[model samples]
Target chain A: MSVSSQDIPTAAISRLVIYLRILEALEAAEISRTSSSDLAERAQVTAFQVRKDLAYFGRFGTRGMGYTVPLLKRELMRVLGLNRTWNVVIMGMGRLGQAVANYPGASDYQFGYVGLFDIDPELVGREIRGLKVQHADELKGFVQTRPVDLGFLAVPPEHAQAAAQTLVSAGIRGILNFAPTMIQPRLIPGSSEVESEWKAVSVENVDFLAGMKRLAFYTLNPHLRPSELKPSELSSTELEA
Target chain B: MSVSSQDIPTAAISRLVIYLRILEALEAAEISRTSSSDLAERAQVTAFQVRKDLAYFGRFGTRGMGYTVPLLKRELMRVLGLNRTWNVVIMGMGRLGQAVANYPGASDYQFGYVGLFDIDPELVGREIRGLKVQHADELKGFVQTRPVDLGFLAVPPEHAQAAAQTLVSAGIRGILNFAPTMIQPRLIPGSSEVESEWKAVSVENVDFLAGMKRLAFYTLNPHLRPSELKPSELSSTELEA
Candidate 1:
């Protein structure tokens, strides 16, 4: 059964991943069965939302018993396409690229950082943790020959778009861009209209800038404190409504 | 006017920073006025949510006319504490730490990476991108003298808790920890609850792990295709109900 792209909401997909993580943790702790409420509590979401999300995917729960931890974990792992290893290429062997390459989380997720690309002559020949750095000029050929599934962009903000375009041109489907730039790339001519598929480019700027702004806000408005800036339970309820 | 801790939600505080970024972009583009709807569209949120969020801080918007971009921007900047420069220290001068130390986002947000600390003797004497790598043993003295408001923990998961504890003990308040491990440190006895407040540690593991799980799920469950994942729009009837 070949799965197409429209069966699940991206938000639901993201949540499924979280559920898998919680299930993994539970499995590690020698736990088996888990109710929707328990999973929701662990995942920091509501049980109704969890059930609805899972229902959207497929019925995998029992009425009274709820969900079997191991079974649901397997189902989620299957749904998320994590059963196979994903080969990742890191563009720009800069500080951020190197950090991603060395991140244990990436390793834990089974993302194999097979190669590193850079324009720096000094870094091109260097090896970082056994992964040899290659020249950025080789990116096109490397992608064609190696068929990398995902590309991580850690280049400077100015070079981010060019790097993304290069990756897209090289037939890379998924991208995890780290550069702080807005990438509004136009789709190739004759491609079917897909409602602007925004790739998961996790920008780390939010936390840093947010923290700075929070501090600044508190400084100027001496009466308006940090605790007061957080979303209240009532606000979240209203937003959901 | 001293602001108490109970006013805003932490999530909203984070969004205020995001709003500030958007405002800065608008200001750069020379756009003067923006409606809550416009802001919501750009920021990928609901207009009502934006209005509600801004209302918590103060009334910066006028009915029928919308918000003054420049004025709202200035207010947000002042509210987020971005007016003052924040000195930051990166603990665990490994690849992750070095990456964060050289992060352009931090520099753009006025977070000065004053120092990098590590236990490794080899790294302690080194300098990366002008920031001196200091001995971790000197963290206490450095924090006492320099009075850093924020600390970035990029150390291995095992060392994250200790590094955070050290920073907290040194009177640092905000922490942006990158280590994948969960740090649940015990609060010191007799310390004021407000001053010795729980550090707002945002986990960066969700993306990598969640993405992996999502990919894995789609891979195994060939029946569940990506195109089927679109969220169903809430109908007027549903809203009425």
Candidate 2:
């Protein structure tokens, strides 16, 4: 079966990433084959839910047997566009930005930090994790010379919008915003709101504060955890779990 | 309307967080009343979705009138358990932990950093944002002296489980795990598999790598974006949008 991006639910895509992690763990343990039930238990969802999620892309497992772990892992990786390395640039080299730049997981996932930018005069010209921090004004010139696939917005909330605009103007494909504020696609100078080019720029937000709020809710209501719910209940409320 | 934790969908809870953020923006702009359409536009979801999500909590709006911004925001804060301050401690005082400890947003939401812990001797006794880093072994003693509602797990993947166990043993109510690894509640000593006490410890995972992967997929297939989808199409697949 052929697959289009719209054919899959956004939650399924997030779960695919989780499924890929499970497959990686299984591979490390030298496990070759797995069933939907195995994945469901580890993913904290139902077996049928796992099958339905994978079915959106294509078929994989046998009726009585199971799925080939490595094969499914490869397919999921390919679907998520993780098979290749992504060159990244960090905007606003604050503590969070510098920490992400030095993070070991970035290299593990092939997310290379090619350039770093900061507006602070003291931070500019300083070297961090081998790459020299350049002034934010130098972003456009730096991007023209080097292809940056993803731009990380780690600036304060007040500066997030301008930083995002700079990334979009610099022709960056995607943004992983770490700011607490929401970044919207404002109308370009000569373009109508409907035809704005900024719409083409993909943005994904990462908020530890939001995660903490979820934790707070769960802490207040531990009896209602998605992972610990019954299988029948799992199917009914598994959205974004 | 009576509301149980199980009555609400996990995705709805997440949307409530988003809605709360939007309400905060409205209040900041001095807006008093706002309609579902107004919230829907900013949140990038259908107005019907906003109505349905709020319905899970209780009645808030009238037939023709909109919601009171501050009132709705206060209700959401209560539902999300964010009304009171949560005393938090940071585990694994590496760069990520230090950044989180020093992040200004922490104070904005009342996530006070009470204590900092690390395995490294060099880091121990060092100060970050007015809190001195303590050795990991002192967590039990520290918790006994003061209340620690949340624990931020910023350790590497290899050490995540041990650190998580330490947090659980210290009676931390919740954990915001920043490690890339999956932290499971293994069976505690003398407890049956199903009766493990660790299950009571709430854990929320924050993976910037997973967010980056989502960015990759969206970059590859911007045409299938959830926010840009038609209203008719949105209701069908807004499972986790």
Candidate 3:
């Protein structure tokens, strides 16, 4: 609680997840203690960055022994707000939505799959991965009645904004938007005095197009990787930037 | 070729795509001659960062006038290797694979969907979005006879590494992996005296689990965003870091 969320960089928060993944793997491999340098190597980040990102949350790394795998992993879990189970729903039970619903990693991260939804009538009564596909129209009512901490927008690009609006009205605070379009945090107009206040939510997009665009850049410019560049000119320059 | 890809930061590459999108949207909306500060607000990055990221490619921002719309967009297109169309294939007919095959953003980014391949006998020869699904075994033969710049790996987690190896042996360079697993760079053993060598391929994974984790963090700690934070300390530190 000492460190406000605003105190940490969003990039650091993202890197923390990567660190958590790496630490989890190392812990599974029975590695007890590791240095920031080693962790930096696995994470493709600098030692100073690894240390600085961790330092904001308090000292997880000992001066000499580096970071204890289990201890650091626990700290990251709490920092990432993954210490508790998050009930989630997948809107738009399309192929992508189905894939997300059945994705195996969700359980590992404690994301509980509670509901499946779609706007199409044909998909409404269908069963996907043991959950019945509810109408997209029911989203607000369902969320108001049930506990859904997160929503996954796997709808088509054209339907994305509408789907996001539905989720917002449903009181979804967190959204993992797979739709190609970037969903901005907008004010939802209130109808009455009781609801005139505005609400803003968090949206994280898992855009493979951006990933592919990055791949295209790296593939076309393989020589650009920092490791292959001149040490003095490359290391501190971009890392600091 | 004037700027080595290494000289430009990878983070900048990611931002360039965002800038490209923002610029494209502006172009579509008939806006021209926007400043770095305005671009920064739309892209959610710092004005200095917008300039610094662009400076790596070439000077796009004018001393006071900011950037000309079409010129900057054209330069970014060239720098991102988006000037040419990339022939691509999706190597799975599964739910996620089908969705990727149907993803509309690829065309907007100059990625041409050339082929679809899957290992399932039933899926073979089936037309998905008008492209015939070829057997996975035919990948090497097809690539040898044709040109494929990228591949989308949407196979099950267990088959990801092997599928990636197959794509590599087929000489495909870029891959956007959708499996809920991390595919690392590994030694690929080639058969026979003429082919007894190992090669590496670039992979970008679109893991929603990571996105969801980030969402959970923000949902739990909403005060982190710059707009919500106290105006003082949240400005430059993380942006530079």
The candidate 1 chain B region of ten consecutive residues with least summed lDDT is B232-241
Candidate 1 chain A minimal-lDDT segment of 10 residues: A232-241
After the best TM-score superposition of candidate 3, give how far the Cα of residue B26 lies from its true spot, in angstroms.
2.9
Question: Against the true two-chain complex, what DockQ does each candidate achieve?
Answer: 0.31, 0.49, 0.45
Off by over 4 Å in 3: A186-198, A228-241, B186-200, B228-241
**Among all candidates shown, the one with the greatest TM-score:** 3
Write candidate 1's Cα lDDT for B194-216 as tens digits: 32354343222213344444544
Quote the lDDT for A118 in model 2. 95
Global CA lDDT of candidate 1, please? 0.64
**How does model 2 fare in lDDT?**
0.79
Over A1-241, each residue of candidate 2 has an lDDT whose tens digit, in order, gives 2467454667787888889888887787677878788788767667888999988777777777777778988888887888889999999898889878876676776788899999999999999989999998899999999788999999988888878888888888799999877665531233454335577878888887788888888888887666553323222212221
TM per candidate comes to 0.77, 0.87, 0.88
Q: Please provide, for model 2 over B199-227, each residue's C-alpha lDDT reduced to its tens digit, 9 standing for 90 to 100.
A: 77777888788888888888887865665
lDDT of 3 by residue, A64-86 (tens): 65677789899999988889999
Model 2 ranges off by over 4 Å: A5-8, A44-49, A186-195, A227-241, B1-7, B35-52, B186-195, B227-241
Tens digit of lDDT per residue, candidate 3, span B1-241?
4576456666788899889877776676566667787678667778889888887877766576667778778888888888888999889888778878877788887898888999998899998888899999999888988889998998988898788878877888778888888765522233533123222356677877789888988888877854522213112222211
DockQ of 2: 0.49
